[model samples]
Target: MHRSLCLAALLSLAASSALASGFPVTVRSCDRDVTFEAAPKRAVSQDINLTEMMLALDLTGQMAGYSGISGWYKMDDELKARLGDLPELAPQQPTKEVLLGADADFLFAGWNYGMKVGGEVTPDTLEPFGIKVYALTESCIHIMKKDKSSMEDMYTDIVNLGRIFGVEEKALALVDGYKAEIAKAIAAVPADAPVPKVFVYDSGEDKPFTAGRYAMPTALIEAAGGKNIMDDVETSWTTVGWEGVIERNPDVVVIVDYGDVTAEQKADFMRKNPAFKDIPAVKNNRFVVLPYAQATPGPRNVEAVKTLAGAFHPTVN
Candidate 1:
């Protein structure tokens, strides 16, 4: 009986060793001990941002499902044509049944909130089914122990995603090109010129939702030769009273159009708002509308900066 017990323990150890050796190591946002079996053949992306990054890296062929294509930021025509047949993975938080029924080899996502809120899918949740998950570094709330984040973090996320997809070379090339363009644009702006005071009007309905210091809107403002009027506000977003806008009286008001809101509606809102109309931006008609995708820190945010610079300094043209 003693010999049989020892033999069984030895067999178990060997089996554990074999399993460990067979699985591939994949580091993600939360912690690193994730393991997978070779490259995933079928992938499900929960956010459009991750989907776009995968497509940029030429890994869209591996995608079995995705979410958030119809709202906010829609996929480009070429991608739509190519991926017309794949299943829609539901908006925001998809059901567990849908996620599991897809039989995806792996799951990639930009926002953890989706899972935390209602998706009911977590790393441990998928582990029993032999599914692996990776979170975008940009969307990671904790990393390097920083409260606020920057555009460099987005670049790092893109590169990390590239590494996971085995397309590091392509990702690096894209990052390098974007950085070069941004650097060129920054150089064109004279250092001595005063930065324009800008307000990022993210949403304006009953109460305006504006970007504060802790987000990409602030970074975009700095990049565009402007100072975010809300730079002193420590939070990522804030709902402000019309009196607050009157007090700030910004030089430029950048309206963040989510495409869900039309330019006409935004213009009407600005003109009709009793408190905002008297502001310099509204009075002088220096309102600039930026797309929601461009305003957010991602692979395309630098382009948004260029657009802003051109709008702010049209005389340079």
Candidate 2:
């Protein structure tokens, strides 16, 4: 009887061990490959979009907190609810002190989002502090020579995050869902539908700040059956002369709603400006407002693409 009881205990222990997570998983981040011995217990994600990536993975339990969200971007009710009780460590960008103080084991940041090139808070600087930084794939253009941004870049980040957190199934499922949802949404547009020429109006009175081919919006616009007017600019995000805007003559202007200025205000500015009077988008009063979170790469991109598709093909859906 004693031997049987001991054998049963050993079997139970072995079963538990078998079910344990496989550690030391290696994931590619930008040009470097990183290995994680175990899932991060305390991770800090930077920016609203990056934080949403972590949240979409149901990784709130692993997060220490988030940074660079509430600073420039307005938090939506849905996002706020998902991040309940999670502290906003930094209003803008995080300092090395903040990560070290939180005892953060990992950081999810990008080039322009959180860590700038040679900036104070970068992957190299944070490495010595025991904080492993996962670079946002879209922002890799700052450091590495890469192809133009694609929806696949976002999917890659989601899958890699899942692998790092031991939730591969959930990540892949979410990506599949996004792809299906986008396909269904754009199905309303006819195959021979004219591809609308779109312009992304972020901000700037002197020169318009817009996204180029390297930015996520290029892919989003393409997925929505529209072409970005600035796709040939070779920049991710930069200012362009109004002459270029007049020359391109975008059919629809996608307004990014964020900061102090309202989307309506931006539209009003475009309509009032004499220089933009002849522009197709402004002349026709065709404008679609996309929330900042939705415009950038993250979970909200699928919905953003749907919004653009509906706007670009007005009669389709």
Candidate 3:
């Protein structure tokens, strides 16, 4: 009995040591390096995308509070169940005071969305408080002169957060699962199907706001076997004249479904407008509606790809 007890104690110690081996994770963001000495016991999510990511990793228990644009799109039921009444730090971006009061050691947010450059609650401001901020990889280029965005950015952010929270295995599995789902979706597209020219309509009736080359929507379009007509623009989101849309005359238009305006209203507006009437998509009603959440850089990107693929190629089983 003495020998058995000693062996059990040794096995327990070995398990604890193995778990401790994952700590001291270091990841770079923009131009700065953020290191996690150990899993953060308290964290704040500044964006709904980040909130969903935390839920995906089963780290909701570590979340102290969350803030950002809510009600843009309804979260999945599973996510809603997991989220369950977490305190709201702010309706939009939390002020420095709110952040401080939360006493969180970690913050997950986008560039401009969370802590804007030279803003009140920057990484510099938070650093003095012993807090580490991880900027969304897609927004890094716009804020930090980093490389252009890619789907990999989202995957890397997810994995990095996983490492910080000591959920490396879960994060890797999530990445692999998303990759497989995307591959399966893309493979369903017919090889010989004509790629549709897609126009992303993000609102703004007067000037017309749309996604550009650096946006995640562009990457989703490419993955869906479609071409973003505005991919020529060298920025993320930009305004273009209706003349540009008329010039391209894309085969399909993707209406971003978000706050206030409904997808049907956007379609109707296009149908009634004389300038867009001549467009092939407007004429044939080839408009695809994508939720605002899925269109952004996050876990839903693969779902966005699958959605676009189905709309682009109806022949795909």
Candidate 2, residue 14: Cα displacement in angstroms equals 12
Clashes of each: 0, 0, 0
Considering summed lDDT, which 10 consecutive residues are worst modelled in model 2? Answer: 15-24
Instruction: Kindly list the per-residue Cα lDDT of model 2 for residues 1-317, writing each as its tens digit.
Output: 69999999998887666457756689999988988878899999998989999999999999999998778867878888999999999989999999898889999998898888888998889889888989999898889888887899899999999999999999999999999998897888899999989999999888989999889889899999999999998868788998998899999999989998999999999999999999989989999999988888899999998999889888877
Candidate 2 runs further than 4 Å off: 1-20
- Where does model 1 exceed 4 Å of error? 1-37, 71-79, 82-84, 117-119, 142-147
Name the regions of candidate 3 deviating beyond 4 angstroms: 1-19, 71-79, 146-148
Pull out the clashing pairs in model 1: none
Please list the C-alpha lDDT of all candidates, in the order they appear. 0.70, 0.90, 0.83
lDDT of 1 at 103: 80
Worst 10 residues of 3 by lDDT: 69-78
TM-score of each: 0.80, 0.93, 0.90
Model 3, 111-174: lDDT tens per residue?
7657777888878898999988888877775665544546787898899888888888999999
For 1-317, candidate 1 gives per-residue lDDT tens digits of 69999999999997787555543436556445455446577788765556766666777777778876664555567658756687777765655677678887778764443455234677667778877777655445422234454667668767766666666678899899888998888788777766678888887678788887666777877877888888777655568776777788888888887657776688678878776767888888888887666766565688788888877776544
